[model samples]
Each structure stands twice: as C-alpha cells, then as structure tokens.
Target chain A: MEDNKIQEVKSPSLITTPSGGWGASVHVFAPATVANVVCGFDVLGFAVNEPGDEVIMRMTGKPGITISKITGDDGRLPLDPAKNTVSVSVQHYLQSVGRADVGLDIELHKKMPIGSGLGSSSASTVAGLFAIKTLLGDEADPAKLLPFAMKGEEMACGQGHADNVAPALLGGFVLIRSYEPLDVVRLPHPAGLWCAIVFPDVDVPTREARQIIRKNIQMKDAVTQWGNIAGLVSGLFMQDIDLIGRSMKDVLVEPVRSMLIPDFYKMREMAMGMGAVSFGISGSGPSVFAFTKDEETARLITQKLQQHLTGLKIGSNTYVSTINDAGPRVLG
Target chain B: MEDNKIQEVKSPSLITTPSGGWGASVHVFAPATVANVVCGFDVLGFAVNEPGDEVIMRMTGKPGITISKITGDDGRLPLDPAKNTVSVSVQHYLQSVGRADVGLDIELHKKMPIGSGLGSSSASTVAGLFAIKTLLGDEADPAKLLPFAMKGEEMACGQGHADNVAPALLGGFVLIRSYEPLDVVRLPHPAGLWCAIVFPDVDVPTREARQIIRKNIQMKDAVTQWGNIAGLVSGLFMQDIDLIGRSMKDVLVEPVRSMLIPDFYKMREMAMGMGAVSFGISGSGPSVFAFTKDEETARLITQKLQQHLTGLKIGSNTYVSTINDAGPRVLG
Candidate 1:
C-alpha cells in the first residue's frame, strides 16, 4: 500500500528481501494464451505476446493473506483476496502444500482485455500463483501450479479447463492429453512460427461463447477433429509445417462458435488468403488468431485484418508476434 | 504353370529381374499387422513378424490377370486373381496408373491364420500389390501403395480399412490421420520395442468383429479414446515408453469386442504383470498382442500367455519380434 503505483517494468528482476533468499517480493508476468488452436479443441494451446497480466507479491509480517491492490481492471474484478483469482490461486497452492497460513500481500496488474477469449483470467491465475511459489522458495515443477490456475480460472470463466491455463503458464505448445489424471505434455515449438491475433471490440463473454457450442457433436466430425489433433501433434514433433497446416483443421467447435463472431467467415477467409497456416477462433469466440510461418507475413495479415475491420467501422486491436517460449517469468 | 511350389525363403534378399529391368518373377512379403492398436480405432496400426502372407508374381504373356495357386488358406480364398485380395490390389494399382492391361500371373502364400483377428487378409492385400509394384518398376512411394492395399484388403475381409494394410505395407507404426486425402503419418518407433503376439485358436472373421461394434458411440467415450490416441502418438514421438504404456488404454472398441475373446482380462493381466507396456486385442478378437521394451520380456510374456492358453485347453500360436522396420522389402 506504500508505493501504490509500482510502475510495471518491461524487464523485471527479482526484488531481494532482508533474508536475501529467492522468496521475497516478486513480480511474475504471465503471457496471454490461444487455446483450442484449430484442431486442438479443449486440449491444445500456445502462449502469445502483447496482452498479458502480472501479479505482485510480498511475504507479509503477519500470518494471513491480504489484498493490497489490484489495478487497471476497474470494478470488474473482485476486491476480496479470497474471492479473486490471483490470491485465490495462491491460496490453493498454499493449501495443497500445507502452507495455507503463509502471510502474504497480493497485487494484480491487468494488461490484457478481460473476457476477450484471450486467456485473460488464465494469465492472472498463472502469474499470481507463480509469484508466490517463487517467493516461498518452492522448487516444485512449474506445471505443479497448473491445477491451482485451473481452479482460479474456473471462477472467472465458469469452467475449470487447463488448455489455456497450461499454455499461459508453461508457454510454447502444450497438449492436455487427459483431464481425469490431469496429464499435460509439452510439445516441440516450430521455429519461425508467427501469430496474428485480432481481438474484435466486442463484449462476448466466455460463458456465452461456450453456450453456443452443442453438447453432442457428430461421430464423423469427432473422428475428423481427433484425427487432426493427432496429426497436429505429430506435425509439431516432426517439424513439418506442411503437415501442421494440413492438420490444423477444426471441424467440431469452430463452425458453431463462428456464428457468435461478426463476419467471422470473411475474417478467416482474409487470413487464409494471406497464407496463414491455420485460421480460427483463439479460445472460444470473438477473438480470432491466425498462425503464419514468417513474421513479415504475420504483420501483413494483421494489417489486412485491421483494414477490413476499419472498413466495416468495427473497433478492433491486432497483435503480431511470434509464439512466446518463455511463459510466466520474472521481467525487470 | 512352372514350379507350382515356390519355396519360401527366410533370409530373403531382392529377387533379380530379367535384364535387370524390374519385370521378372518376384516374391514380396507383407508382415501381419495389428490394427486399432489399443486407442487408435481406424487410425493406428503396427506390423509384427511371422504368420504373414506372401505373393509370388511374374509378368504374363496375354496381358490378363490369373491366380495359378494359393497355399495354406484351404480354398477359403478366391482362385481368380481379380477376386483375390492380392490380385485385386494389383488390379487397383494397374487401373490407377492407367496400366490395367499389364498382366501378371500370381501365386498366393497364406502363412498367417485366415480368420483369427490377426490381419491375415491385410498381409495378403499388401504383399500381393507390393510384388506387382516392384515387378512393374513403378517408382511410386510406398505410401501410394496403401489405397490399392485397402482395395485388396476389402475383398479379403469384406471391409476396406487402411489401418491394417498401411502398417502391413509400410511396417513399424503408422497413423492414418484422414482418409479423404489419405494422409498417413509414419511415426517413430522406440528401439528395442518388442511385440508378443498370441493368436489363440478361434475363428473371428474381420467382418463379424467389425459388426459387433456400435455405429454411434457415446461422446464421452469418444473423447477418452481420442485423448489416448493423441497421447499414444505423442509418446512415440517423444520416446517416452511409460507415457506410451499409460496411453495405450482403449475405451471404445476393446470393451465391446473383448466379449468374443476367452480369458481376455486374464491375458492382459498376465502380460501387464510381466512388464508389458501395453497389452490388448491385436485387431478384432482372439488374437492378443503385448508391447514390451525388451526382447527377453516379450519372450517371457509370450510364454506366460501361451501357458495360460494351454491351461485353458485352447490351441494357440505365439510370435515374438521387434517392429519390422524394413516393411515389405524386396526379397531375393
């Protein structure tokens, strides 16, 4: 609460405390994620740049949790640390390792647009818990923090899914093989892979986007989706971009979600015409992303999409960048 | 009509052609395949050794197909090469290249069981077409031979599926992602990965085995099956044998078809106990396979399975071999 406005740093370093240990005041940054990447439906995701969230934490003098500050989100996010995803995720982490009583003051810095289908909540959920885990000198796997992120994200999106959260936390390409045992596998990231993400200025909540999808998909379509999923994973591991392009076909969820996004068909057509390897919804709907092989092509694709949106008088923001390999880390 | 008895060779090399121009009497071998491969239903398969089929072929004078002799099948298979899977496959290959007039007198060698869920027909389908492809000096990719194999396999089993035929022709592990464009991805095989295949004395035709499966499966079960399929592919690529073991779970087809196999549960239990990474029905029923990391373990598992079958008074045949990496190679 002292320096209420701790300026967010593009390049952050760890803040050393009196103990001079790894667990002091830490600022962790988590990147935005693109889930349901074409063929991957609730199983595949990758982290992207530009829009993300940060969590600030410090070990408190007393032995309980406190929410000191949460900036930039307006009144959209909850104030109570118990009710917030950031601190709640920390709470879940602490409880899991039998350290729930650890005193800490939590802070949230929101940079990404909320409910934009860009894994905004997942970023906070990942960054918040990640900051505390580092501060507490916990050497456990970063993936161990994913379940907490999933729990925290459920409060924001009304679904406890790991696809977006995994990529937001682990970075690169992540595949959630099974949910029952919660098996997540990190796949090889192809070189020179660029992404053009366009978040159309529309308030399509994650809940509404999910509701549009049917409960039961056709068996044939499911076969196609799963086949593409296997092929997608294979292509990435084999480092074959052509196979990746051919495999990134989503036949199950995209058709239904496209109805919710305005001019979704045309938007995808323009992206595909510009030689995007894959073009489809990022997570659920509204926010669209396209994968390309080169950065220049990604930039051109982004500009074309923006120009088309400008012509239609629809407000939109586009981010052109490569897939983020370093997911949630300290940036000073 | 010369040499009705063409002696089969074990350590066979490439068959020398007349004038070294590729067209001469040649023998090609296709290993028996394990289709379905636990979780990949219609999309995954791998080849095993022994109990396979062979095709002996030579160019004909009148430019018309003929089946001179067939061994071991006991008249169940057709005498007409056009009707036989081996010759039918050659016919498909001929029509595809607009060289249907290129005739071949053929002989079939049925080494594998006829209808015991061991990919007997698939072996014939692959070897027959492969022999002709080699004899005609067709420089087509081995993968291009799959559709013809599918055509031939269909005649033998009354169902056209490349799951078995692809692996039989190409060898090792094969993933058929999509059938429309016939996208088949050959996966990496872990070194020393041995297969213990036990063909119990039972008659379960490929058609009847397929008939027992429900047309429309529950959506929940489909998700599980596809998830495991993706996991299996990933495991093979990453060379994570434990992950492969965990992912070899089949939730869709195995449960329904296991009813036809005697002591199916007990067989899997013994195999799993003997350190088999994966154990399940090889293709349809009666024929069971277990994947092990070493040859010694594979032998032990096979012995245990054979003993169990013997105790049950069920006649059976067992074969232990690593993945046949050299698929359908030229034999001298």
Candidate 2:
C-alpha cells in the first residue's frame, strides 16, 4: 500500500468463453421509457414493457470496435460507432472505466419507432452500455452508468438529459434529483399501477421539440408544478390511484410541447373521458400515455384509442403494461 | 324546497353564556407554525410545539362582532373586526358559512413573539375562526377554514400564503398542491420524526422576507428544487429520516433571506455539523429549525444551540418535539 504506487490486480484470461464474460458476447435488453410522466418535467420517468431496444456486444478479435449488424430500424441509425447512440454510450463507459483500448463488436435492434417521443434513443443507449456492463463484469453500481447514457443522448440528440435513461436503465419510477451533480433516486414503485401508451405514426424530433420551449417559465407556473411534483411522488408511494391520476398533470412542459402532437387535447379528453386515470404527452411528442389501475382498463382504453385513430387512417401502435420494475436484463 | 322562500327559525336568547356555543363562549387555541419547511417555498410547512397563540371567543349580546380584549406584544394588532387579523378571519368565516348575522366576542392572547417568523398572526386568526367553527355545530370540514386563516395573513402580512396557516390548522406536514383552486393535501406522517427550532430575539418581518426573494428563479435551480421537494415529500411519507435530512435544502429561498439573519451561515453549519439531519431557516429568518431521528439528538442540538448564543447577548428560545401530528386543540 505504498503511496502513489499502483495496486496489484488479477489479470483476466485472454481465452474466449462460451458465455458473455470477457471475450464472449452478451445480449442486453432495455425497456422504452416515458419521460416527464405528467408532473415531473425533466425529472420523473418510468419504464414500459413494449417498445424497447436490444443490443448485442462482445470483445472484438481485431483492434478498436466494429458494428456488425443493425436491425428493426430502417437504416436511420448511424453505422459508425461514434455516431450511433448505443455505441457512443459504450465508448463513454469504456473510457471512464479505463478500458478505452478494449476492442468490441456491437449490434443494435431498434424495436421502438425513431422520433416517436417514446424514448427510442435512450433505450438503445441503455441497452448498449448495459450489454457491455455484463461483458465487463459490473464494476460500478448500475446507477453510475447514467452518465454514460447521457453521453449517448448527447451524441444522438445533441443535448443530454436523464428523464428517459434513468428509468430505462433502473426501471420502476426514477427521479432525476439533480442534473449538475447527476443524482437519481428510484422511488418506491406501487403495485397494480399500469400504463397505456399510444404511439401515433408521427415524428416529432427531440431537438425541435426542445427548441420551442421558453428558456424561462413564469414563477406562478413553477409553484403549481412544484406542488404537483410533490403530490405525484406522494401518489406513487401512497398507492392512491386517484391521487396519482389527479397529480399527473403537466402545466409547464406539456402546454409548450403539445403543439407538436395533433389533436392532443381531444385525445387527452377522450382518454380521460374513457376512464383513463391521467393523460399526458409521453416524453416530447406524438406519443401520449394514460395511467390506469388495471390491465383490463388499460386494454379497454387502448382499444378505444386505437379505434379513435381509425378516423385518421394511420397505423398506430398501442401498448398496455404494468410499470416495468426490472429495467435492463441479459437475454438468457 | 319552496323556491326562494325564507325558512322560519327560532329566535336566539339575548344573553351570552359561559361556554362558546349558540348562547355561550368557547375558548380555542391554535399553534404557531413554520412555513416552507426547508426546500418547499409557499408549498410546505409543519407545526412546532412551543411559542404559539391563544384566542377566546363566543357569541355576543349584539348583532355584530366585538374585540373584547387583546394582550401581549407591542399593540400592533388591531381591534376593529375588519382591520384585525383575527377578527377579519372570523368575519370571513361567519359570512362564508351564512352565519354573518351571528354576533361574536373575541379575545386574543399573543403568547408567541410577533414577527418572530413563528406564524404569530396566523395562529391568532386560525384560533378565532376555528373557535367559531367548533361552536357552529361543525357542518363544514375543518380544512374549509384555511381560507379564513389566509384572510388573517392578508390583514397581517399584506400578502396571504397558506404554508404557515395550513399546517397550523391541519397539523403535521402539509403540501399546498394548487393555490388557485386551493387544493391542500395532508401527507402521511413519518414515525419518530422530531423537529427542533430556535428563535433568537430578532425580527425579520414576513413582508421584508417576501421582498428579498427573487420572484423568478433560474430554470436550473427550479429543476434541482423540484427534485428536492419531491424527495422531501417522499422522505416524509416513507419515514426515511436520512432521506429527509438530505432533502431539506434551501437553494432558492435561504440565499436571499439569510442575508437578513445575522450569523445564519455559521448557525446552519453548526447545526449540520452537530448531526442535524437537515437545517435551514424555519419560515423566513431569525428562526432556524432541524429534523432529527431521536428526541435525545433534538434535545442535545437545542441545548447546544442555546449555549452557542450565550455570548451574543441575544436571549434565544429553543424547542423540540416529534413532528406535531395534532395541530391545535382546546384547553380545558
């Protein structure tokens, strides 16, 4: 333990294994997330079961990293690892762990629609870094990997925020307590809380959705939002379904972001009128979500929402899931 | 059931009786409270055990209200029903519940220091209105009386905010979810959560405190503050003492208002260093509070805080108690 002397460490075997350890490959799946989740603007989020991403990674035989295959996405995602959201996150993780020289092969599957306001980029990024995390044998607490996810977001959207990635990576409900310090908390997840999301076949780019928002909000709005944020957190923990429904309202972010979604007000009204507990834009978007108490209610609402969309003559995807408690997992 | 027909009722006896009922007098006590409760500005607060107000009131001989007596303080409180904080609230309550014709006699005991950041005016007002509420056969919910308390604050502080009066009236930790419709929620109380407060012989008027704070906050600060507010609420509900301690931070209000309190920084540092789970200005300034897990820790902190003030020639009063669950009660 001499001062300033390097400590001894065990060396890994160079030989490849059949499973995803060291030289072998691993497949990781990260769920899609709903950011802002009503009252929490840039702060609260939760994971859903449908619309996620899958990434495959392994130590490469040659130097540096290689992108072997990309699926689901129609050539929209970049091939270069540096330009891709998932690969960029892997790079950040590798560099931070002092393993930048580690050569890797990567593959990505974008199951969720790109630019659909369903946390597509964050899902892919979470899957990528998480896949690598398993191969590298988990050094840091899983929450520590959030910064790498932000790096992925920065590479993909040119701005970084954790509202999506935190929940996508850690599951349950997560609050981004502070951005400058990058602190996140996993709130107590309530049982029987289900979510229904309708992803309309429309695109609202994250960058453009962000640009329309005012840099400063009225203090009046801030106070309303503050109380609701507290109420929303309480609703989730207390497991009071009506309280959660009433609290899941967005006065600050949705009023500004809702312009991008067509018939946003009518759809929200329909959801609420049809027994959805609370309704709001999921992330920045064309995708909207409603929270309900039961799977039957969620399914009924999803059918009505889909039937309502028939008038527009566009194919839309609707999903109902219990709040995803397990965030990312290795594909067995 | 007859349209626009006035219903006949029995005439009341002229003489006022001993107990505050239809023909008697009733004595009511309301406790002074600390608003903002740290990270929640204009949104959160709780009741303290010591330094509160008492009011005595009952039906009068005449068809109007009378301020029979006022004691304590430097004669700042008014006697006129409209001008006095207590009387105006009583007036508002009577008029609101269609009991405006009922006469009332009122006496106020300013047991707590006025302008001490101890919710002096709010306590007196709450007591006066609540006394009448108990006497009126209790038709309206107790929370319905909050507006009358706010009317009192309006007369006293020139602006009405419910943070102080809500906790004083309801007891325990309270969150003002929406001010417009005036939605208030009583959050779940944490077990073994004790609060300690110290009042130095200094006055920082509520008006002055309100003036110093910047109406608009930076978006970055708002996000951080939002997270802390949610965390504080969660901490309280979950009964996580450490989490509550970590979340009781005042980035928005303290920096501005603390300028008015002498040695504020030193006092806060000393309290935190002494194992205060969280420490900050109780409501505005001159009074500071901390939350601790054990009563012994709270007692120790209070004693040391009082001792630390020995050299300053300022006599300070310190109090500690488990978070006040029962807000205000009548004394026999």
Could you tell me the lDDT of residue B286 within candidate 2? 79
Which predicted model would earn the best lDDT? Answer: 1
lDDT of each model, Cα atoms only?
A: 0.79, 0.79
DockQ of each: 0.46, 0.56
Superposition TM-score, candidate 1 onto the true structure: 0.91
RMSD of 1: 7.4
Instruction: Name the top TM-score candidate.
Output: 1
lDDT of 1 by residue, A252-329 (tens): 678888887878889889999989988889898678998899988889988988888888888887888888887898
lDDT of 1 by residue, B4-89 (tens): 11112122232333454434688888898888788887778888777688888888666778999999988888897657777777
Candidate 2 per-residue lDDT over residues A1-332, each given as its tens digit:
01111112223222233364456888888999999887887888999888789988888756577888999889988888778888878887776666777789988888888888889999988998888777777654567678788888887777788899989988889887667556577887669888999888877888899888777766667778888898788777777676677677777788888888777898888888878889999988789999887888888888888887877786688988988889988884
Docking quality of model 1: it rates as acceptable
* Clashing pairs in model 2, backbone N/Cα/C closer than 3 A: B19-B24, B19-B25, B20-B24, B20-B25, B20-B26
Model 2 DockQ reads 0.56
| Residues forming the 10-long window of minimal summed lDDT in candidate 2 chain A | A1-10
TM-score of 2: 0.88
